[model samples]
Target: MDLPRSFTIRESSHRILNPFTDEKLATLGRALHLAPGTRMLDLACGKGEMLCTWAAAHRVTGTGVDISSDFIGAASARAAALGVADQVTFLHDDAASHAATDPVDVASCIGATWIGGGVAGTVELLRRSLRPGGTMLVGEPYWRREPPDQAAVEGSMATSKDEFRSLPALIEQFGELGVDVVEMVLADQDSWDRYVAAQWLNIRRWLDRNPDDELAEQMRAELTTAPVRYARYQRDYLGWGVFVLMDR
Candidate 1:
């Protein structure tokens, strides 16, 4: 079973797919207090960069689950390349109904909450794979301030202005869900640029290689407009972050 070629291409280059830059990712790792022997599960783990790097750097053992086999293969290679093959595993699987092979210290569904519908639902979904006292890590979007216009919301990838709450409201929602927001790492403008702008180069290269592909037109449109849209709307009105949570 093959995903759309565009999806495969994006999955193959997730260091750029993600909205967080490498420095932000490292900051997140430190904020989570990830350590040796910590068992973790990464849902929607694109290319498993975070999992593999954390495994090697912190000596953590983890499993990364993604829908793309290409991502799983790349993740496996990354683990081995980092000499942490024994510590991390990658699987091509659906994450919506994923169950941990065993209870783990951390369960993460970063930047892909659609697997559980949305943020609150995703937290519940991650809870199932976590040990009694384990943490749930979610990377999600919020508003820097309430969007002043529907177009601004659309630019941030939401259908309506109500799709995401403001940052404090997002944290409060987690509290209402009975989870303590223990740690968080926010994405800065530069990080967002890295995530969105880098895609332009990849898309440009793809169009060069596969000029006749049907998706090429759509990607070209995105490439032409995304940078301006992102700068005008998302950069000014939206925010993104990864939160580390624990049961209250």
Candidate 2:
């Protein structure tokens, strides 16, 4: 099983595969105060950046699972490049079915919670792999401001306004799930630009090399319009963050 070729093509150059920048990710890792030898299970771990980097910086060990073989290969290469190959492992498998063989110090489902159906279900799924008192990290988008209408929501890449809650409401959601929101690192417009705008360059470079590829036109169209759409709606109205949670 793998992500659609188009999706991987669009993000071919991405390391983190989310809105987070390298500096922000490092800051988050430092803030967590990860102890040496901490075991983590990261589901839908695109490119395995989080696991690989943390393994190097915090001296932790982790397993990352993702459906994309391409991403798994990239992740493995990253681990080796970072000289942390022994500290992290990447599996090309469906994250939804992945359960840690042993309880881990951190359980994470970042950016791709649909693997567990939604936020609540994803939390339940992560909990199955987490040790008591261990941390859970969830990366998600929240509405920075209420969308004025359906059009606004659609412009922000959401099907409906209900797709995301406001920032406060999202925090309340974690509370309702019996988890304490302990720490978070948010993405600002600049980071959002870095994430979204980089796709255009990747798509353009891919199109130049593989002009006859089946998905070229689709990528071309997206590259043409994505910047405007993202700046107009997503950059201003949508906010993303990685939140640290602990069982209450």
Q: Which stretches of candidate 1 lie over 4 Å from their true place?
A: 1-3, 10-12
The C-alpha lDDT values of all candidates are 0.84, 0.93
* Top candidate when judged by lDDT against the true structure: 2
| Tens digit of per-residue lDDT, candidate 2, span 103-205 | 9999999899899988899999999999999999999999999989887799899999999999999999999999999999999888989998898899999
lDDT of 1: 0.84
User: Taking the tens digit of each residue's C-alpha lDDT, what string does model 1 give over 1-248?
Assistant: 42467776543455534778777777888877777899999999988889887887788898988887777788888888999999898988988889896899999998899999998889988988999999999988898878888888898878998788889999999999999999999888888877777777778888889889889888888888978998889887878999999998
- Which residue pairs come into collision in candidate 2? none
TM-score, candidate 1, is: 0.95
